[model samples]
Target: MARPRAPNRRATSCRCSWTICIEPDQGTRVKQRPGGMPPHPSQVLARRGLVTSLTWLALVAAPTVAQAQFGDPGGEGTAATDTGQIGAAALSTPRYMGADHNRLRALPYLSYRWANGWFVDGINGVGYGGSPTPGLQMGVHVGVSPDREESDDPALRGMGNVNRGAELGGFAHQRLGSWLGGKLSLRSHLRYGSGEDRQGGQAELGLGWGTRLGERSLMNLGLAANWANQGYMQTYFGVTRAQSTSSGYTEHKTDGGLRDLRLSLVVIQLFSPTTVGLLMVSQTYWQGDAADSPLVQEKRNTMAVAALMYRF
Candidate 1:
């Protein structure tokens, strides 16, 4: 007669014995005597939580990876493990459109790839995009607007806060082959914000080129045009009759059209297989009604960011 195997103390009493060894050579085993037994509730909950986190990470990592690829698009292959970057960025931005109080803020930068063709970029928001090897790719994304508080600027003392709200959108990218010894591309995205008083939309169009500087460095340059809808223009730039009476500004009504023209540059340096550094500079020229609003004190805006990143 064969010798009876030891019972698994972790498992409930059952007639059938199961010996599951992940690696028999290593003596790793998961033994259970219950054939019809379901996974423990804690195990099930842990698995579900892990899956949800990974999905969220993927959504945030894809855009950042795509940007780091510098138009190369070769990193989209499916993998068994998740990869991600964690970092922080120091950003210099205007308190509002024209506020003189420029604030330097440190923001967390995170991105993750749970699998091929899926990523989430914390700075750029969450989305899914195809591999860069395809030359043509599209994605859907969601982002949140920055909070506008009355305390950010003296001019905004009575304007109250433009509470941060969600923005959902889609984007498309097309590689236009090599030009100037770099990959040329066209990109566009349209986003709609959801807010009771600020539910408005904006659109962007851009042309860009990216080049590899060396074994571990890359650079990109782009020019973009931005457009806004009437609702968006009104929310940020318009002063209503009541607001004018309370804020001591003339009542102003505005129509939406061209919002701004932007020129941007990004440089990335890879310190190791798992570490990176990035710098971005962008200048915006406000146009039309956005420039004409009393809230807009400056027609030209400049922003810069420096970040250090690590991947796993």
Candidate 2:
């Protein structure tokens, strides 16, 4: 599976409950509340704020920790003190990008950055990351893309399984000046390794904004888009003639283009100078050729996560 990006320094967290719903024009009917009354206006705002907070938390915190240990942000090649973080995280996400169901996963949250720029973590995999110039950070790493099983969803009965494989990728993030009293940044990632053949490739680009909510809290808001090659899209979204014969879905072929768009929110709370808690929520909308695929049971996907970490 693709790993979520960690948060940066300019972000913070908030308190609220979030609800995900498709827009009226999306052709998906909204489920009414038990009383059939729409949510109050304040409730809607709160939910929106919650979403933004979670996305911001995930996007801002991680990079700041990594950069602090790798080197100073000014790219002066200064030798910084060694730092590391260890903890655990739980993630709730869709069984697959377009699956209507969800799954809960436990992940080891660990990262250590040496003064020389090399690092290992459950998030960014193993890589060397540092600011090559002021306001810019880049790195390369190797990670695993988890496999998909037909049993994951009954809808995939005869679609077969995809084996996990090694993926090679690199990432770049740049700080874009402040916006509305918050710091803004742009990030991009590209990798190869997704199908049974491990020949698929994917790319992501996003914008993140964050700010402090208080002495011990922060929040972040982000928007991102994903793209894939023909091999990757076909593997995940396409239904072959044989698959149609068995799965009872029409054969569908997918071509590469814009895949989906995502909006995320994150919130972070500090219990001590070295101990922190993070919560994040995100919504994704499938689009282009991927959306047209028969395997896509839901066009919108929601994901949530919570984690705790200690720095030493």
Best by TM-score: 2
TM-scores of the candidates in the order shown: 0.71, 0.74
Whole-model alpha-carbon lDDT for candidate 1: 0.56
lDDT of 1 at 109: 58
Residue by residue across 51-165, what tens digits does model 2's lDDT show? Answer: 2222322432331101111111111121144566677767777777588988887766556666566666554466666666765667677766656778887888999888877
What TM-score does candidate 1 get on C-alpha atoms? 0.71
Q: In candidate 1, which residue ranges exceed 4 Å CA deviation?
A: 1-81, 120-126, 131-133, 194-198
Count of residue pairs whose backbone atoms collide, per candidate: 11, 26
